[model samples]
Structure formats: C-alpha cells, structure tokens
Target: MDFSVRTVRADEWERARDIRLAALQDPAAPIAFLETYEGASAQPDSFWRERTEGGSESGGGRVRQFVAETSDGRWVGTVSVLVERPSDEVRFGAPAKVDQTHLVGVFVRPEARGTGVIDALFRAAVDWSWTLPEPAIQRVRLYVHEDNARAAAFYRRFGFVATGETVAMPGDESAFEIEYELPRPEAGA
Candidate 1:
C-alpha cells in the first residue's frame, strides 16, 4: 500500500486518462463526478492530451492535478485544483466571488480508499492552493451532490464546512450540489 503523492507531469497524459476513465466507472461516479464514462471515452487522444497537459505542471498556475502512485507505478488516485479569480468565468456553480481554488475530479481506487491516499492527495491540493502567489487564495471549495453522503462526510471530516449555498445539478434542475469550503488559515496560526 506504499504510495507517493505528487503533481502529475505533462508527459503523464495516458496515465491521467486511464485513472480518469477508471474513476468514471466507479459506482459513485453518478454522484461524484460530472463527466460520464461514455462521454470521456468518446473523447479523442488529442482531447485527453490537451486536457492532461492543461492540468499538469506545464499548465502554468491556473490549474494543477495531483496523483497518488504506488511503488509499482500504478496511479490509484487523483484530485485537481482550478484556480478561480473573481474575474474568471465560472466553470460550475456560481461565479467566483473571491480568489479561490475549486477542487474537482477527485477519485481514489477502491483498494486505496482507506489507506490514507485520499488524505495525502487532499493535503497536497489544499497546500498547493495556499501557496499560489498574488491575489492570495481566500478559500478552497468543492461541490458535492446532495445524495453523495460518503463524500460529504469525508469533506466535513477534512474541515470543509457547508457554505449555505446550493446550485442546481447540471442537466438536472431538481437535484442540488451543495458547496463546501475551507477558508485559508489565519496568518501565523
């Protein structure tokens, strides 16, 4: 169960694609992710390549993707953070009201779920968010489908609190995705 967590490299597109497809196959995919397996699978290699590169280290500071890889080189988990500036177009939910990062594309293999890989991935993501220069990240936020209790529980355990904001789930107006946030820690704390 030994694994290391690190930002994904620009050249790791195939590995990124594989892990993302696997996540879309997980039973929780219906609630955990906005992308469908069918949709993702239909994308061409070029699409994946561009998407992966945009989230990798070469993507500049706007986005970052972190992966947990076993000693044998199997990527088992991933989380992506997208920097959101107040003037940036919103990717989901409401437009950013402050400088922040949105956590998305979270996944951990079933076998790696309880091995602390998730915690490590999240730590790297949030820690990286706080380190972004200029404007300063005021918070790290994510949206969870209301029906996804397991994910909500874990977010709460990780110190994210519900922001009293709800947005209609895309393509399903009746359902809601609740916003959760962890504010930046007080300076010198």
Candidate 2:
C-alpha cells in the first residue's frame, strides 16, 4: 500500500470525519481516544467541515492534522498535533513543558494497521512539529492509557520514551495515562 501522508486539506473534512468515526468504533476505542464514536458521529457535517478547516495551514496553527491517504485518494488514518507554549500553559503538570507539540486524536483504521500507514502518519506529525518557527518546540509528546499496551509498544518502537510522567485517568483509579516524548530537533527537520 503506497500511501501519501500529508497535512489534511480543508475540503476533505468529511473524509477526516469518516476515518475518526471508524476509529472510535474499534474495540480499543475506549482506551485509544478521548471521545466516543457516538458523539463524533452525531456532530453536524458543518462541524466537521469547520474542524477540518481549522487544522489547515490557513487557520493560524492552533492544530495541525495529518492524514494518510491511499494512492487512489481514500483517507485511511489521521493524527493531530497541538502546539503548546512553555512560559505559561503546561499540559498535565505545573512547569509547562516548554515549547512542545501534543500528539492527540491518533487513529489508523484497523484494516490499515500494521501496514506501515502508522509510520507515515507519525512521520508527518513529527516532521510538522520540527518545522514550527516561533517558540521552537523542544519535543513532541503524547499520553497513552497504561492499559493500552499495544499503543505503548508502538510508541516505543517509534523512538518515543517514557518520561516518568503519569496522570490519573478521569474515573479510572486503577489505570493511569503515561506520557511519552520524542526530543525536538534544533534546526529544520
């Protein structure tokens, strides 16, 4: 499967929404995503259109969403990176890990899993983080539920390391979300 991984186009919001809804329907959806498929699927088409457009370059960079599309133009997976500033707002902690990108909403269709689409999507997201100019990100990070061992293994294989950080999962005392980080590059990546 020769797939092209690139920043999503504003016009493809429906495609993006479709893949997300599919991901949320997977068995591991509870551990893999923050939202339920039911919620996202119920959203109006206009909402998805606006959401996808917001992640495009024209939207001033609040979020950067990448998608993996087959050679024939079918979108199969997606990931979103949210930029964070170090001086004030911190994610999950007080110090605010300065100048970083938060990886979220990662979803690769089950049929596409293990077919290298994941690496392509991740490369797209990681590469995008390294290109930011202002506040120059120092790292890219994500949180995964401890019980989601499958995802944790993949993150480690992709060069992300556990950062000794853990956050209590809301409503789940027995399980915690662990943080993983990939050091940022000093120059254009």
Q: Pick the candidate with the highest TM-score.
A: 1
lDDT of 1: 0.94
TM-scores for candidates 1 onward, in order: 0.98, 0.91
By TM-score, how accurate is candidate 1?
Answer: 0.98
Q: Which residue ranges in model 1 land beyond 4 Å of their true spot?
A: none
Candidate 2 lDDT tens digits, 58-102: 768978999888999888888999888866555453255578888
Q: Which stretches in model 2 have alpha-carbon errors above 4 Å?
A: 87-95, 186-189
- Worst lDDT 10-window in candidate 2: 88-97
TM-score of 2: 0.91
Give a tens-digit lDDT track for model 1, residues 1-189: 899999988888889999999999999999888999999999999988888899888888799999999999999899999999999988998899999999999999999999999999999999999999999999999999999999999999999999999999888899999999999999998
